[model samples]
Target: MVRISGEAVELANEGSLPAQEVPQTSITRSQAVKLYISHALSTWNARGYEFATILFTASAYPDTLVAAAIRMTIVYFAMILFSSVVGRWVQKSPNRLRTLLATIFVNRASVLAGAFFWLLILSQEDLIGSEGRFSLAKNDTLKHILFVVAMSFGIIERLSASGNLISMERDWVVTVAAPSGRPYDLTHLNAVMRRIDLVCKLISPILISVVISALDSVRIGVVYTALTSMVSIPIEAISARRVWDDNPSLRVPKEVPPEGETPPLQSGTMSWRTQLRQYLHDSKMYFSTTVWIPSMALAMLYFNVITWRATFITYLINVGYSLNTITIARTIGSLFEISSTVATPRGVEYLGKSYRSVPQDEHESEVGLVSGEDSQSVRDTRTLVGLQRFGLWGFTWQVFNTAPVVVALFAITAPRVQDGGINVFASRMVDRAADYTLPAPPVGWSIVLFSFLAISRFGVWIYDLTTQQLTQTLVPSHQRSSFAGVETSMMNIVQLFAGGAAIAYPKTDQFVYLASASFVVVVLSWLMYASWVYRQRGHLVHWEKLGQGLFVGGR
Candidate 1:
């Protein structure tokens, strides 16, 4: 006797069906693959552009190393400011997709403009007199303006890339399904994306090198920029279109909670002060999760180490290593990264299973699962899993992975070592030749150093994957964006301070010592915090079988 509309009938039928038996309206497998490809291409283009910009800046400036570092600091600072504003706007705006698309367009336009300016400057080399050239290199005012404009564009490009990543994550949550008609597991999806990302990283540097070689002239770098932009921008637009068309409901503005209900944190209607407090509170909660703060600290240290490596790369180029050779080395490193990426998911899974029992039928909660009254035991299991996964020894291994670079830098710059007395591994490897150019180190030493770099790179990649998985597990759905934004902002602030320190003491020894001391302090602090966590939760720990299935003839 009840009057039911067609929609109500559909809903009633849907509710009657079992979860797995119900058909889902989600993205097709082909569409998902295409989106992944687009993401990789976008990352490639951005990295290529950055590489070109660094080389261009170094070639144009006299104090190349220090200038590039300063320029990088400015870019980081700009991205921090821009992302904070834009992220808030996206969260609050009714038209998120449109705003995202418009931002992408603006980022591409800025890249084009920056490329044009670089071309203009490079092409005018013959026309500029000696005085003009000197001014171009040494005039602080002109140099500052040029770096600011160029880096601002870079910041915009990075922000746009981040927006795309967030969109992709959201799309997967809302619209993606497993090929077997089951809910998508974030761990599996992240593994696939990481492998693709590694493959992209492997190919992008070689492609960039080829482009640079083909162009031959710095002025022609603009052509490469335009080409990459054309490829990436169109793909992004198409992906956005597909997302909207395939998931029409995503376009609908999210409704506010009823007036009587408790308002969600970070709601658009909240006062600015309220929002700030919420952000801080959310950040604290997120970082307080077992081992997250230290894991994050190590990640930040790795990022800071990269800037130091960039400065080192500039030094190498100044002292006669061709840019091509450096690019080739990086490409080789990426090959190793592919292996690391492939192993990470399995490693995390093994550790999780070994340390604690993860529910096999819990894919729904795997994406944005949070601790609840009924799930408190599960949360405890996950907390113990994290503790065992990245306890004191894990943190130490991560620190050691990247410590060799600092050691190598110290050996190269220390006065005693510079005098060529240390002979255990050929002090000449660190010594400057008579011509003031650094000589190629012995092949054995080169192998050791490159091995260190490769291992460090692998460790960092694993850490990144682990942090992401933990974040997905710990953060609730409603607070994900707020937490993500706060974490990102905090990382940038830390990097800015680190970058400022690097700029202040541009000398190799000074930089290495400061970096080493900081790294040690972070690792020790993490170890202490980890000890405290272990004490609080140690009683929960239990032994579990390993290699049981394989040995027992089980599938």
Candidate 2:
């Protein structure tokens, strides 16, 4: 029997069989709520712009995805286990305020630490990229080893914390809405806001670079970029508090209930586990009708595209530069700020709000449905955020590789094109936009090849969200962390394997082929999401299905 969730795609699968009335609603909420959600999802441009630049300029060969994945999994599991042990230590003390204060302090510290860590990570990457002469000194080897290790740890921590910080935005938006006034559920206005957020994300880096260029140096931009993480942490942290502690929706009064009365428990008592359980239980309703099938499978496929292309860039870059010989205080600024820039167009609500605070009024439907400011936001955010998961990895590798791609493509496509950053960089100007124009690179359809890579990735983003949500909905909450952990671990594995492929290939062509494998896997993964998820919509299959699909496709 056909199910409800996947009905949209299933109907599409019939391929123009007949035009039947498919019911959809418009005018679900006020313009403001839609605006907020759209803003939050708008980071694609910022991230994509960075990827464009990185791909255009990149130079490193990739590492082994298998090795990197395994290492990352091990580290994360260890950290999770450790957090369980130490979280209590930090939370100690009977006073709830004090406990919250302590937790907030750690939260603040993480953001600060993240900034510095991020700086170091970017600097190391720049070192290997900018260092010329293509040397492999003893020092270079040591630095390479250290750079990988640092990046692994640094990214893990940065990403993990960053995820939580972003989540606060989801949670806080729910906390602040006015009661009795619910926003419409699916407004295009939300999408419009998302576009704005992206504008900010894309333009900020170039703006920062312009300032640095004015000084004829990259270091000032880098330092300023790194230091700004300090500002971001607090802003986001308070936003988180608002959601957790201050949200009117989640807030509970301390007054004792009457003997005949009952009230909702405060968030202090409810757990992520409980929230997770309820989510899973409700997901059973839509398992058969999931629309995420194509998008999910595509995501895995796109990851592969990025692997070989970006990795090849990294390997070549490392070969030419010694880690310590190069400096990149400017790039760090571009890295983190880009997210904020992208997020702006996605949602104005995301822009003005922080993840810590939630002051939204709770509007409970007479029937028992809990839909409000954040719920719709969360739903849309989950759907769109997948577009950006690769921002860090893709942006760093791709934008950094831009010069070479242009040169290579120009070489192949326009055979006589001279290769070099100055030349290739200058050619990037559609208008005399870049006053400090570089020389042009000969031949290789650099633009065409890179465009294919980006378009494929964008398709994957659209696919992953639908499937991820459906899967998350079907699974139980207690199992989500483990599920999430496994999924995350698998992604790490993919990256590790890509890295290995980058190194093993004797030539760039072979490496690119290896990268194609990622896309192949992604396509296959989506097929499964669509077919299997559609087939089992109304019943529970072996939880084992998930094990096989965990890392099937991702970017």
In terms of lDDT, the best-performing candidate is 1
lDDT of 2 by residue, 1-555 (tens): 112233333332321111132212222234244324322322322233233223212222233344344444454444433332222222122222233334434443543443343334334433345562333333435544544554444434434432332222222222222221134321222223333443555465556556556874333444554354344444434443443343333332212223322122234645767644433432322232233343234334434534224454443332232222212212332233334333323332321122112323221111011223355433333322222222222222333343343344324422222345233322433445644432232213534444443433333322333234333333222222223333333444455555455556644334445544544564456445546433533322225443532332321
For each candidate in the order shown, give its overall lDDT on alpha carbons.
0.53, 0.35
lDDT agreement of model 1 with the native: 0.53
TM-scores for all candidates? Answer: 0.72, 0.46
User: How well is each residue in 1-555 modelled by candidate 1, as lDDT tens digits?
Assistant: 011122212322221223343344555565666656656666676667767787677655644366677677777776555444444444444554675577567767878877766654544433244544322333545545666676677777777766655544533333243421133344456656777766765666556657667866555566677667766888877776676556544555533223332224443566767655555554564464443554465445533544325655644454334777666666667766676667654554444444333334342133112223234334334432542353433345456855676566455444323334553223334554533334454444445555666665666556566556544434442334434555566677777776666666665435556556555655664565455435433432333433342232322
Best by TM-score: 1
Error of 2 at 426 (Å): 26
Q: Score residue 242 of candidate 1 by CA lDDT.
A: 74
Which stretch of 10 consecutive residues in model 1 shows the poorest summed lDDT? Answer: 1-10
